[model samples]
Target: MTPVSLWNRSFVLWLVGSAQSRFAAALASIALSFLVLHQTGRAGQMAVTLACALIPNLVMPLAGAWVDRIGLKRPLIGANVVRGLLQLTVGGLALLGQQTGQDVPLWVINGAAFLTGLSSSVASPAAGAALPALVAPADLPRANGMMGSLAETMGLLGTFSGGFLVAAFSPAVAILLDGLSFLLMATLLLGVTLPNRPEGQPTSSSLWQDLRAGLRLMRRSWVLTVMPPLVLLVNAAIGPVLVVTPKLMETLGVGPRGYGLFLAMEGAGMLLIGVLFASLGSRLPLRACTLLGFLLSGVAQACMWLWPTYVPLLAASLVFGLGIGLINTPLGTLLQQGVPAAYLGRVFAVLSAVGAVGMPLTLLLVSPLVDRWPLSLWFGLNAVGLALGGAVWGALMRIEPHIPALAEERSIEQPQPRR
Candidate 1:
């Protein structure tokens, strides 16, 4: 087969559409928060509404199976369309409530949030599953890197702009824009046509069987099994960062604006590192880069713990961002390349679900610790965990020169599941 060009029209369209959808999601998040708070003024109600949005992730294993069964093409388009209409409905309701001096019922908005999240959960994993089909094997690294960068960029853009939009116009206007963006995203994806599923690959007879099969597949691959736990730990470690940043800022006398600049610096590091991964990632040694990223991230966090000053902290944030980019880009590319096409959706979904479990747990454990202990202790703990993860991945990388190839070999050796 002739190698497909990485910059082909289909890939470009997928990239743009994915970015648009992500940006829309971020906008919706901000707009929804505004609308909920505006309507209820109760922090508890706002928390419930946000929690509703996260409820779908608990079912991602099943959702991933559905994605695999449906194939990527239609699901991606349908998800975008559903999200678009849902956001538009929510926005219209918000506007209606505002105009009539009556708030939209809490239950109605919460239901909408849940449905929107359900669709969103599928869209994300499908994007990951669909990428390998859109581009050549060798280009997977660059493709994944670009996609990661685009997502991060859009998220930052949406987060920053969403507040301003709500202030200048209204939350409804910001949400309406979110809806339109999804529709635009759907239009862009309409042009993408994925390859048919390969013949003789394993599938299951029922959802339960399929779910087990997905777990079975993950259990068979060392790479798949290890990555998710690392992801969970890394996420848990970062949770405290968000909690401690305010206190850190106060200690350093940086103020709110300094905190924003600090975040921007980290974002800048992420962006630059992403660009590097897109351009040079394929040529570089994956294990080395991964280890370096982990080391830098851990060291950066530890630096903040040791010296919580303005300049040192800012510099640490940048390096920390670079470390994040390195870890995410390579990890994502490896998964996309290593997993079988038939199981990609399930694998990614399961991985995400596992990590999601840790986030709330981390928050539960870390939030209280922040109030009771010095901020530096939590920061130091995060740094240690990250450094430990780096050491683990480094050892694994050394054991296998080519992790993807190793995964492929192991996958082939495992017997196919019965239909």
Candidate 2:
């Protein structure tokens, strides 16, 4: 069979298996993070732990280049295997010490977190870059919509289930489940046979060289110019909200269950919107939808700050999700449609690296401010930040002149590459 037809079948298998595996890991991740904070009562320490987790994202440019050198399937399978082992190790350490009331040491836990983060740095971009081979150009958005929607759904379900597992079985069990899921995901990845990129591209020696190429794409290219930053700004504000919610509840005299309900409600809004986007995303103009999503999310954040009560907060969360779904659904389709398959992974990594910088700083800044500011005020700033991000994208649309909501659609159909 031709690679195209083989990939058609593989795509279906990967989608189903990937979603199922992701569901488990997502639940485990949240459960593990929650366990750390709850058991240690040290939120900052957990933030630092997660900081180590995010560290790989900043360095992913090099990682992506490395993966391209190996086949995409190998890196994916290897990363999953390593991740599964790391999770199992952590779970085992905790298991052996169950009777002593002593848990895994902080450094050990952080190391495991680091490994999981690193695996993601390798796997995510490769999977994204690999999608062009999966289906034809016309089906790209539909495939990407399915991918994004399933991810959102899995994320919501995992988080809720993670919270439940933490409440029911223990964080160790949650971690073990996470490990097994990764193992299963790895097995599935092994089944996929990726194509080798056509040769005679730049043999960039330094990671910095590859990074510069990516930076140039972001600066000069039409599609990436708007997409990544649109994500970054929305991504940046997320950290503060996560921090502020618990603090708000604590100050408001509510318990953890109340906080979970609030978060789940917030997630629920996104869940509904994700389904909506999956259904209608292909019909929307890509650029406009992205720009508007950021704007709406900004408005939602600001509105939440205006009233930190249950109703407004929930409304804001729903709006945030709606905006996110619109922007995120078509993104992979844009890349798969726009970028040459060979260069896609490196470009994805660099964009991710650049975009991740904002989130860590946002997290760092939010952590210090939360202790001093009123929860209402802290969240209000995040809302303002989201709004400003929206404005920037709106301005980009006006200035670029040629770039529009359905620019990708027009570009793909024209038969002439923009460059």
Candidate 3:
């Protein structure tokens, strides 16, 4: 297949729909928390709302099994529909509260947040399953790179744009925008013409069997197994930084807007790196780049605390963003190309599910430390996380020296020949 022949009319239409959906999702999920806080003026409630979105990740693998069984389009469409309705409900409630001159209870908004998260969980597996069908094996790298870039780009824009929209209009308008975007995307999905479907009924077998199958496949492939952990290991530290960052920034008088700016810069860095990956048109030495990127990330995390001035903090965020971009693109490219199509949804689900476990666990420690310990101590601990991720992934490379994708030059193994 041509490296990019799949870039036809249908694919472009899908991209437009997917981009808008993602933009809307980002606006609601990433930026919506700030809106909730603005309305309620309660930080703890905001955290709980965010946690509702995160907690569903643990159940998403099972959702993946359902996704694979149902095939990509059904689950994708179903999830979008659910999310659209949920957003519309939330927006209407926010409006209702405003009209009645009564506050929307934190519990009420959080309940909406839970449904939003559940729909996102259901949609994730379908998205993974859809990409391979959308493009040929030859174009997997380009396709995945574009995907990564678009996700990060939409996230950055929606996040930054949410603030502007809310400031210009109001949270009600912002959320209504989100609801309409999802509704539109779901409608457009009717025309997508996905390239394939799962072979049979969406399966519901023994839980142990599904979990075992997913794990077995993951363990057998370095790209599936080692790389995710390498990435997750870094995020173990990142979760804390994310949790404490705004607080720290506030303490240092950088203010909330500055904090948002720091996040935006980090996202921009990821977006830039993603574009480079999409268009590079050559095989990157995955192992070398992964190692260097991980190390750079560790170094950047360590330096973030040292940057006393707000300007330096912005620079540090940029480095963190760029490093993340460099590491993740190749890793995702390998996963998409290496994992079997039949198992792709489950494999990615497993990765997302387990990988997310680190963040909350790290959060448990971050709250206590920041409250009692020095900021330097927290930053130092994060640095240790980076070194550990770099060290562990490096060790895995040495041990699994022949891991197919690790060879310096790119050589994509074709999907296993027909049985």
Candidate 4:
């Protein structure tokens, strides 16, 4: 079969819309963080607001099932519209408070955050599910890489824009921009076409049944069964690194500027790898690339633990970023290729939820002990986990070929109980 162009109209629209939305989200993230801090004057409240945003991931399974039942376009459009409205409301409230010399209610901000997050949770699976329909399977890796690279670039720009906007105008203005961006994203998505479910073939199974079927299918496939937990492990290991980095930098006397550079190095590495993937496409083997990512991440983390100096730490961070880029693109392609399109929403939702839970849970357990323990301990632990996880993943992939194809899994009409 002839390869389809990666820059087809549907994908280009999706790419631009997604990049703009992500840019807005990154801008809003900074604005929201500073806004809460300025108003509440407490870091605790800021944490609470961020936690509110994450709470919706817990409900992603339900959202995913809904996406599967009703189809993708409506969810994508509706979620963006709702999120746009919510952001605008929050921005309006902040502006009102600014004009009146009063503080916007913390509750209102948190409530808006929660609702917007819920909308995003619904939209995410729908978007992922729609991708297979938008591009040929052979082009998925390049498409995903392009999307990742552009989103990263946009996010970095958005972060800088957020600072500038807040400094030049106000957090309220930046937030309003975010709101408008979402509305624009929704408008753009309206023009993109997706494959529709067959005419007159309505879903026979209840949403709960469909969810169960998704789970059953996952259990039967070695690749699917291993993916969620592996993602969880990687996230869990990485979480403490983020949490402890500031303190470690302080101890090294690098200050905030050095910390920023450290992060920039990582981002630079990821962007470089993303571009490589986009350019090379399927020339790279997914399984080998993923395993190499894990190994690089583990080795990088070990370097951080062993050296703990300014230059070495920066170098390690760059390698870690490259590892992450390698892991994310291939794993995403693996899922898009391995799973039948019918169950894509549910599977992606489950993985997203699992990954979401990992970081917070690990942070909760690790935070209290951070000041008491040596920082190298966290780095060492992360290194070990990544290395072992990679080994286990490689073993699982060996067994994956023996298992029957996930496409053989029954449709929602013929649901099977989990073994």
Best of the candidates, lDDT: 4
Clashes found in each candidate (C-alpha, N, C closer than 3 A): 0, 1, 1, 0
**What's the lDDT for all of these models?**
0.73, 0.67, 0.67, 0.78
Candidate scoring better on lDDT of 1 and 3: 1
Mark the regions of model 3 whose C-alpha exceeds 4 Å error after superposition.
1-4, 39-44, 96-101, 199-208, 227-232, 248-256, 364-380, 401-419
Candidate with top TM-score is: 2
Residues 198-301 of candidate 1 have per-residue lDDT tens digits of 33346557867666676766665556667788877876677656646644665676533455557656666777777787877588666677788999899899
Clashing pairs for model 4 are none
User: Deviation in angstroms for 297 in model 2?
Assistant: 1.5
Task: List model 2 lDDT by residue over 1-419, tens digit each.
Answer: 12445236678767876787767776666566666766676555656676667777877888877665554787788888988899889887776756677877988988888888888899877877776666666667766767766766776777667666666667787788778888888887666656654242355677566555555544555556765775677567676666556546555654344454555665565566556655775676776876777777767777877888876776677787777665666565666666655567777787676677666677766565656666777566777776776677677666664433222211333343333
Question: Candidates 2 and 4: which is better by lDDT?
Answer: 4
Error of model 1, residue 320, in angstroms: 3.0
Candidate 2 residue-pair clash tally = 1
Worst 10 residues of 4 by lDDT: 196-205
Per-candidate Cα RMSD to the true structure, in Å, reads 4.7, 4.6, 5.1, 4.0
- Evaluate model 2: give its lDDT: 0.67
TM-score of each: 0.80, 0.85, 0.84, 0.83
Q: Which is the winner by TM-score between candidate 2 and candidate 4?
A: 2
